[model samples]
Target: MTRRRGRHDGQSGASLHTVLTAVGANVLVAVAKGVAALVTGSAALWAETLHSIADTGNELLLFVGLRRSKKKEDLEHPFGYGQERYFWAFLAALGIFLIGGVLSIIEGVRSLLRPEPLSSPWVGIAVLVAAACFEGYSWGVARRQLRVRARELHRTLAEHLIRASDPTATTVYLEDSAALVGIALALAALVLHLLTGWAGWDGLASICIGLLLIAVAALLARRSKALLIDESAPQDVVRPIRDAIVRPDWVADVRALDVIFVGPAELLVIARVVPVPDAVEVPARDLVKRVDGLRQELLRAPAITEAAVTVEDVPR
Candidate 1:
């Protein structure tokens, strides 16, 4: 149990570090892209700038969620601030959709309706390359942070990237991936504009990038929403937990169980364990010990954070 607690701390720390890196890099990238958009009037550059801004805000929210989640238990909330993590993560998703996706699409459509000749293609290209490098750095950190646990869950890189409940790392990876691809689209548009002397291609590219961002944001929103709505632990996890409580010698039967994720590494579990008919009330004390032992078994699954086992009807 102690070792499991240590691992939980490690997970939170890793999430913090990755999110901070992403936020810092995104600040620089947002400024650079914003300036490039102003100087060049490239629609794609404007789209990228907004993307960075949205990413920066999302990272802050994730960091808040990460930190607030660690708050100690209190009378008002005996279960602690675990749900704070999920709430903020949900906000982060909405931010992605509203600030990142919606704004980009609106700008893209406006640009397409009224084309503007980009003044400096080279400036846009250089900024895009720099943004890509910063995104790569952020992605590297997040990947390293989540890699070990991700493998233990038998998830591939893409699966972890998409399904990770930690918004900080997940947001950074998604934003960075979108930023890299947006750079490509921007460059393509710039080249096309230069080649054909047609300004509409730049706007068209912006629209495409915006559409792409919407798709990514939708995915993030869906996952976060699921977490917020009390999604259950995967069967791979629930089965073993059910098995653990039933294995205890004093337990006659187990009924109704509720498992919830309080934080990325924390779970708030409510289980009803029935005792054997002949088991004395005092022997039930040992069952609590055995149930505590189940913490180790639960930790093996990696997602059940804290389990609360309540013995349901002791034999009189």
Candidate 2:
């Protein structure tokens, strides 16, 4: 039997490993919070549990996307199933909004209406701390993966997290951020409930956390939509392609250039290249090969999987 290797052999494996770990941790945390909420009747604890469940679901979706997207190019999809990854990612974002955002708001409002008495403060604190530790570890794993890319792109970690072409990068970042924020909100509600003897504040905190999650999820959805709709290439990719095609000795001038992103790390470029006299002297076959080779080499840095080049007759 022939064994098939994954598309992201090295880097993608590490990413998948980390995300799986994160999902496991979130599941554990959710179970713990659900138990605690049941025992103590704390709205804050219940809200945290719901958020973790949503996060766990999103991670599973990401894993499915990562795996499905690795399918080899077939007759139907000559370009491969790369966009399958983005489509699954969009679904994950929507799940985050619906399961995490809407449900959380509803629960928070219910707590405000029925002010349940606070339970054991110590248990809530312990669960929050444990959840925090796991979340921090997951976030750390994602940060380490991004460090190299950030340095190569000459951008800070924050900038790369928001703008990187890879959907995994954005998904991981948003999930981690939401996890931490949710913990804070849970903690705040528990403390307020303990001090003021008002369960409504705990519910209010839950509402606030839900709003924050909604905003974050919306941002993620917008970005994924951009990718799905064939958004224009990022500056990092566009600038490099322009520099490569405009190099002297071969290209005299470029009359027009157009670029579109086909996948996370793939772009299709179409250009009108006016070759110099020396370039024009080459045989037609040789010129085509040379230009194709040049294109492949130029695109290597940006993870371009395929490049097509056409040599047009020098326009009159």
By TM-score, the best candidate is 2
lDDT of 1 by residue, 171-262 (tens): 66777788788878888988889899998887777777878878887777777777777676665446667887788677788878887765
Q: Over 4 Å off in model 2, which ranges?
A: 1-8, 281-283, 299-302
| Model 2 lDDT, residue 60, Cα | 89
> Against the true structure, whose lDDT is highest?
2
Local distance difference test scores for all models: 0.76, 0.78
> What TM-score does candidate 1 reach?
0.85
What is the alpha-carbon lDDT for the whole of candidate 2? 0.78
Evaluate residue 303 in candidate 2 and report its C-alpha lDDT on the 0 to 100 scale: 58
lDDT of 1 at 54: 84
C-alpha-based local distance difference test score of model 1: 0.76
Question: What is candidate 2's lDDT per residue for 285-309, written digit by digit as tens?
Answer: 9888878777766556545555655
